[model samples]
Target: MSLIDLSKHVALGIDIGGTNTKFGVVNHRGEVLEKGNLRTDEYEKVEDFIDALYEKVHPLIEKFGKEKNFDGIGVGAPNGNYYKGTIEQAPNLPWKGVVPFGEMMTAKFGMPCTVTNDANAAAFGEMLFGAARGMKDFIMITLGTGVGSGIVASGKLIYGHDGFAGELGHTIVKPGGRKHWSTGSEGSLEAYASATGIAITAKKMRAEFAESMLNQYPEEEINSKTVHECALKGDPIAIEVFRYTGQKLGEALANFVMFSSPEAILLFGGVIKAGDFILKPAKLHMERNLLPIFRNKVKLVFSELDEADAAILGASALVWEK
Candidate 1:
């Protein structure tokens, strides 16, 4: 066995998505020095995926490896646990059962490893290198395919007893509304405030209002990005779509603020790129729903993270934490 250096200032970050696995080597300054990706769906077994990952990532690890200067690896995945370093029965992943993910990566790479839910990793990235820098108490909300959250209190990310805490996305926002396809849960925030939720709403709006500019696009084409583009073009129906989405998101956030009393709620992900078209209504609704004490206190802001680097940076940030 060859000796390894454990004192490097740079860390390896890996963000495992359902479709792709993004990996990178990053320094403490939040800069990614080397990066690459692989199609996750290509590997049927988790072990195969890990082997492919190790094969692909090892060259960078060796090239960037400096004597006693390289930090360990960090990973972010759906339903990942920091304590166990395992990926639980994630609905989106190819694996069917709990996989000892972090341990596998550590052994393959020969270094320390930490794993956490992607949302939690995003919060870490925000705290270490993005908007939440220097702040202790805040919540990072990811409004993507599904709503995801990471709560920070007293400057620490809350992991709860089972390491599955901070699932604000599944909280009931509408008591009897749409059913979540995966969990069979009705009216959850994830069903109302996510990009999928927006697409669903767009369909309903298209049906009710014939004048919708969305009518020009096919059903499959009516996604969040299209809606945002139409809204920017002064399309009334598209504008209303964002309005409704923002209202629900805002109300849910208002409740979140009352419970956690966070200083700010940082919004991340592609949907927020709609900018004030979504944020204005969200901010208005959030403040309106907030109690007297919390009304004017919590700040609603977009993330400062670079879309390209955020995932890797967030995952890498965990190495520093560990």
Candidate 2:
């Protein structure tokens, strides 16, 4: 009988999102052994944030370390630079300026750490355990509070020269169009396609139709989830918001397909819960804008990973990376 070695297979994965931070212990097969989350907005100082994280995450590490060799830590955050292991002026994070996040983690946790853009980590996760497995080229787009993208070519996440490549969300799709809340960029894909953007769209469009279901909620209460709820009930205004958002997303995707000619484009995050309301239009517009040869070739699909788990899995996959 053959015995499986548990050592050298366990890792800690931390996903630092704008609103929350999620962490977990994972094995080599991308299974999350245990997980928890903390509010990212609660800490004004990065040090406090790290300390708080350590308090919660250390026990899991201790639990797993009893029998297995722990393989260090991996982190995914907005604007994280893999080459430098830093988070530079991430608009969504409370911390200002460049933060040596990797060094901080190593110092705090006594483990080697690797950090990369959150979207890039998602791509790695997809390659390692999700739909992109065995594929040489693909794109992963995360539509959360903001839009983010990770590009993989020849089975490698493209870090570019600065380790910040594949920011498709910030790419200008509509010059002088909607403005991004954080970057203040005009006409970017993120302005119209993100979950935040969808809510904004709903708020704006609802005013035009007095009888629209979206008008029921107070202005502050309107959000993507509420919009989705209205959309599910066949509210025309909510449905139109998604259609408009999808149109913009599809147009941007057409450009991406042309640039990389990837085999597929995988969409992830809370916005995906809208299902075909967003997917149908995105696929339609993407195909409509593409050249004949490029049309009908690129597969646009939702991620297979559980939304709550993908970030942790992605973060952990970085640990196993060569």
- Candidate 1, 1-322: lDDT as tens digits: 9754433478888888888888888987887888899998899998899899988988887788644367788898889998999999988899978999999888878899999998888888888888999889999999988888889999988999989988998999889988998899999988877899899999899889898889999999988999998998999999999999898899899899988899999998889989898899999999999888887888888889854367689889888877
Candidate 1 residue 110 C-alpha distance from true site, Å = 2.0
Number of the top-ranking candidate, with TM-score as the measure:
1
Tens digit of lDDT per residue, candidate 2, span 87-199? 99999899999999999999999999999998888888888889888888999999988899999999899999999898999999999998888789899999989988898
| Residue 192 error, candidate 2, Å | 0.3
Provide the overall lDDT of each model, using Cα atoms, as 2-decimal numbers.
0.87, 0.90
Among residues 3 or more apart in sequence or in different chains, the pairs in candidate 1 whose N, CA or C atoms overlap within 3 Å are 7-68, 7-69, 8-69, 8-70
Q: What is the TM-score (0 to 1) of candidate 1?
A: 0.94
- How many clashes in candidate 1? 4
